[model samples]
Target: MESLAPALGLGWDRQLGPSLPLSKVTVSAPEKDKWRRIEPTINTIWPIVEKADARAREFVARRRAATRAAA
Candidate 1:
């Protein structure tokens, strides 16, 4: 998932966003459940989660920064 950060950023930035030609697909419940179990065992998922969290925090910070800039 950490590998997905760049693509995710592109989507968020509207640079590589979802559109008719680039529609996103979701995983099935069973696959999702399997991934849930694999996350903790793999240890690789932790960085991904941290990166996502940091991204989210950065997004919030950006929003707040915009408000501050406006003020």
Candidate 2:
């Protein structure tokens, strides 16, 4: 990230973001069972999730290429 910082014009001065914290909860569960309880709902929302994933991939690809060029 520091390597790409200059190319991307990011710095403390710009303060682009640290929007999401690098933290995670320990998800111990019969989470599969819990998820199965909502299987129908997940099926319904999965398409939207897929679309968002595709968009994010494209955005990241573009950003990487731009950073490479700037480098």
Candidate 3:
């Protein structure tokens, strides 16, 4: 059967169109206020974030090397 996901706007496969205009953006007080506490937690996690980024870079380097070898 043909997919209903695109018709229902549920899946990512469809390149439907540009997102709703910036003017249409929804502002949520709950979401905005929740991040106030998270800001300090993110600062505390800075070292962890740096390590994760370095690991990702190493993974990408390994993948590129393997791709070059296969080619």
Candidate 4:
């Protein structure tokens, strides 16, 4: 899991800037069973998540450009 941190754009410390910590948690049996059902749904929708992230970044860039032009 630690190895996948970099792939997920996670950092070990806040030296570069602000960082959000992602840690593993111990789940109860019921919680684990629930995740077992939900995990596949998340996996299926991951592509949509990526697409939305790209769109958000593009929107931010366009907004910044418009702000600069206005200024």
Candidate whose lDDT is highest: 2
- Please give each candidate's TM-score: 0.34, 0.43, 0.37, 0.36
Shift of residue 44 alpha carbon in model 4, Å = 8.1
Candidate 1 Cα misplacement greater than 4 A, ranges: 1-45
lDDT string, candidate 4, 1-71, tens digits: 34333433455552443554444573543334676667889889888798898987786676656656776
lDDT of 2 by residue, 13-50 (tens): 44446554534773654334767877999999998799
The lDDT for every candidate, in the order shown, is 0.56, 0.68, 0.60, 0.61
| List of clashing residue pairs for candidate 1 | none
Tell me the deviation in Å of residue 20 in model 3: 13
RMSD of 2: 7.3
TM-score of 1: 0.34
By TM-score, who's the top model here?
A: 2
Poorest 10 consecutive residues of model 3 by lDDT? 1-10
lDDT of 3: 0.60
